[model samples]
Target: MTTSTPAGHARVAADAPHGPAGGRTALVFSGQGNQWLGMGRDLMAREPSVRAVLETADDVLLGATGWSLLGELAASEGESQLADPAVLQPTLVALQIALAGLLAERGLVADHFVGHSLGEIAAAAAAGALDLPEALHLARLRGELMRKAVGTGRTALLGVDAERAEALIAVYGGGADVAAWNAPEATLVAGDAGTVEAVVAELTGREVFARTLPGDIAFHSRFLEPLRTEFTEAARGLLVPRPTSGRVVSTVTGTLLEGGTDSDYWAANLREPVRFVQAVDTLLELGCRTFVEIGPHPTLGPSLTDCCAHRGVTPLVLPTLRRGEGEQENVLRTLWELRRTGAVRAAAPAGGHRVRFLTAVTAETPPPALRGRQAQFAARAAAKALTALGAAVPGDGAATATVTWDSTDDLAPEAASVVAAPVAPGADTAAVYARTPGTDWLRLATARPGTGTVPTLPDPAELTARCTARRYVADTAVASAAQDADDVLVRLRPGTGTGRRAHLELAVRITAAVLGAHAPIELCDVTGYDDTVAGDRVHVARMADGTARTTVLDAAGRPLLHIARSAWRTRHTAADPVTAPAPAAAGTTEAAALDLDALRAADPATRLTLLTDWVREAAAAMLRTGVDRVPALKPLNRLGVDSVIGLELRRRVAAVFGAEISVVRLLRGATPADLAADLDDWLTDTPDAGPGTAPVCSAPGAVGPGPDLDDPADIERLLDDLDALSPEEVDSLLGRLADDAASEI
Candidate 1:
């Protein structure tokens, strides 16, 4: 059968032997340096298939390392251990495998698979060359071995061809070698730290773009040779040779896997240089045109584009997930792109039997009595109905009950009936349905029997050690002890109110703050709620499954309400377009004209007052709060100004007043009054300077010591820090530095 293809794509026979579009689809997996703290979280909450894969991986990793893989992924930015190779390697592999599984379930199966560096293990698993458990084991062992070599060497990416990279490495010949040939102009060099740094310095001096990769260990180089024997022996016990279901492009050998992967092959994969460009060539030769990157982010898209461009072909490159973007949206977009390009056949609807149940109040139309905890009550009603239908009841162990809210609408309070039915004839999961009295039943939520054991919670003292517990309102509904950015413990105080909606809302707000979720709550799974009392504490921890678990405990610390998962729904609309504001011309606006002469003539006390008022109003605008609410003495972060907001405030200051305030100072407990004092000092010291003059401290004690520019490592660290700043902040900083240098001259 033949089908029409989208414009710019070629049509192909649907029944082709290689694939749905005759070897046009390939799944690419990226290795390290692409992972972030909250990757794969939304998929775990929305896709049951992805959750199952993650759960299986967590089980395998926990048994092997006595640490939960899910726990690490859900860690707060401040508490994250993702930078450690021992943790990151397995985590990336697990996430990649989960993404591949999700894509396959969506009918976007690939005809070929390729992986970069450590990503090959996941690619092998996805290609059916190795079982999931064995693949995870191999990844874990690889990470452990790699961790031992940390700090011994470093890796650097230089904008040069492989030949040029080799020549440069030879110039500083201290064991540095070409690690990976990413593209015609992108080559990775790695070896001893000093040698690599010397090479980077030389290239940088010659204006060639050279950057040191994040991790300290030099992967795919002789620095890893010491680990070969141990890694091979360990891998030998876990990996069994098996044929791949799909063609596996080998980066290490730069060829197709003719037989299969074994212990020695894995050993070579660890130590040998990566021939990524060659692997891309092999895929191109096989006529693969659509590349889907299955990893945390689109780290390989540019390289893939570059490699394809070299062959005079423009391939469609898609990313399964992107850093700081919605995972569900990204994956769905990729799937759509695949179907659009005719690389995957269109999916047919699979109709199935669904069980439904009645509820007192659905999430969409919750009554006043069940306002905030609608999902909790709805799940309870559904579980009872499922039990009546002979479904398995969730036990009070580590296992949990899964609940999802389908819709939201305000309806009159009633004893709303629910229809409970199994998702499949004998499936453990069941769907709950509800409707208004005269309307058809709408799917409300799904309940699934949870597997595995619950994690142990920290002691109350330990949990509250670094946290400041505060009530949601001035003393009204709920008090929460936010432990870092990913965990919160809430205590339901007595005599607050009869309604529990406030408590639930407070918990949701705190959860959103920690998880950085801006979506509305749509579904929640509750467990361990057999009994409860006033003053019971609710502990909510962000999970790797892209949800937060709320565990209610009594004063003595017994579990009362265990909400295993709370899912959020983000509303996307094409009508609501975000357009950037046009840049203002220099000195064109009245606000930009700072009266330097008037400011220099004013007294110190008056200047401080003027600066303080300006700072307060600017902060209020950025914080989206009333100026009255922003106290002059309180720190900006204390008034809900996070790192992102703090950067915006800095940009505003730079744009309007032509002054650069340090973001580190803004977020690290600096008050508006403190900033005003700094501005006053700058005005007093640089009286003859214009508005854009470099910032100067009247007192030497105003700023902290600067980094030593002579030290390359320190310079690198400074540059990394600067990279996090906004473009305006960088411009302001450079202007200030330039003005300072001119004044010295």
Candidate 2:
């Protein structure tokens, strides 16, 4: 797993992969300030649908920033740029949405959301912390006030090496000062220029030059008091929603952000340690093995990838791979990654019966045994036939093959002498050798075959890999358990041979029944099955009832089917290489299969529950945004749902919650009026994401003059005027008059 690292850089830690508590984890997001030109260009180009989102962002931003934003805005006011902090925050918001939308389309999402300075706003937007427009305005205000507060302050950097960086900062000036390490190789030093310069002069040539970046402004330092105050005032007029995810990691320390409190996120975030390493570590500890940094310059990309490679973890950063190449690459990568993480591959588990290979009895000493050629052909042919009968291999189409030899020991007791096939080194059923019948096997002398065919087995290696069937998955083991269970359970259809397909279906049913603890059972597998000899004793011989009764009588003519063996194990011979499925069980078979309509007709409560699930699933698939989905929000809201709860419910209940539908359309409208108002806000909020334009729709019908002057006569006079005017003229003139009145005010 050794990966190339940037040269001249010391290994952060030699033993990175050796984490104490198993691993680490972190949530990361780019704030508004970090956005640059070509930010989402890569993602936008990939998914043409996502371009609409970018267009929406341009509609919300542009011309407001008064700076360059990679691409021009699609607005009539061509002069305006969206680089303004206020507008940029929204731009970042839109970018994150478009990114999330693209990811969802392919099925990728995150375990948590984390944000840096302005990035916190985008993070909030990502987790539904605030709507798109509000997030933009907040980020813009933060940037503006922060710039105002700092007032051209300088952040003198000492060096990129953590030790050198810290030593340089300390030697440079820090006495009562702070030391914030951004990464192993980067640190941000904030203070007065004279002292900073003095310290730099003190520690000359120990590291890279004191670069003395211009816009230092002591970002994330206490110098932004005025900015914090202004930002707070602005935040009050806004309404932020609950985060759609569980935790929002604070970039300050890679810890959880305190909800409803911006003091910690604001003050400490600016002035505190940027413990990104610790945050990443925490995420890895939380069971997140993959790291995905979304969009833009990818400044964080190198740091993140280096960290993961150093720590022996996987890093899936977007836009690197995509940025210059354009949106197409970005979108495709996002979709593919999302698909890797987001979608569930439904599997119909495996099934196989246990044939205890009697280890003690060997063909070498006594019992006339089938030749090696005979055993191989019988087994191979039977396996091929079962595969043809619809036996599902793993999704990979390659089965987990396990090899073992049949012994005569389980069939009849004998001394523990050399058997046909010696136990493989790691035989799971090694102890059971005493009970198995022995037979010759191929070059698989190193492989310990399982007792019987396990439908759940991945490859043959799995049987020895697990101790318990439920804890492990072997189609053969569980099916064996079902076959050996005390209950007769149910019967198989007459004239139907118990073939490979039948055993596989039975394995699925049996595993589901036993592991699921026999919850109302539902089983269906219509594929036909064929196998080599499936039983050592029993045969589908005729009976007095004129039915194909299974009997186990030997040459002595004693009934073998009625003989008391719990599970029927398979046997092999050259002639019986292609064994048919066992004949259907002798007696009572299943009456019929259950269908949705019949289940729906079962009980009222059950029916509602089922129908409700169906409706929710439908809603998930047809993800809607803006006005189109407004009507769908009320029912969700009336259910008393919150965003986090809604997300959780969808994950737990809905099959397609991974679709990532709009929270706006799925909530916020308790009534049609509320929904319509929500839609109007969505439409208008697009343009007015700045200081004066917000609080859209003016809360329609809000009495501007305090209830029409509260004069009955004034109302009467207005009515009289309306009556005197022609209806068309009154309507036509009304709009103009209102505009004039507002302009005058």
Give the top-scoring candidate (TM-score): 1
Best by lDDT: 1
> Per-residue CA lDDT of candidate 2, range 52-106, in tens?
6667655555555654333543333454445444445556656766665454333
Candidate 2 lands at a TM-score of 0.39
What digit string (tens of lDDT, one per residue) describes model 1 on residues 459-568? 66666674564322111134334454556666654433212232334444434433434333433444443332433565767665556765555677765445456664
Prediction 2 global C-alpha lDDT: 0.39
RMSD of each: 21.3, 28.4
Runs with alpha carbons beyond 4 Å of true place in candidate 2: 1-27, 31-49, 55-89, 156-167, 175-180, 198-204, 208-210, 214-216, 241-245, 258-273, 306-323, 334-745
Q: After superposition, how far is residue 309 of candidate 2 from its true place, in Å?
A: 5.9
**TM-score, per-candidate, Cα-based:** 0.48, 0.39
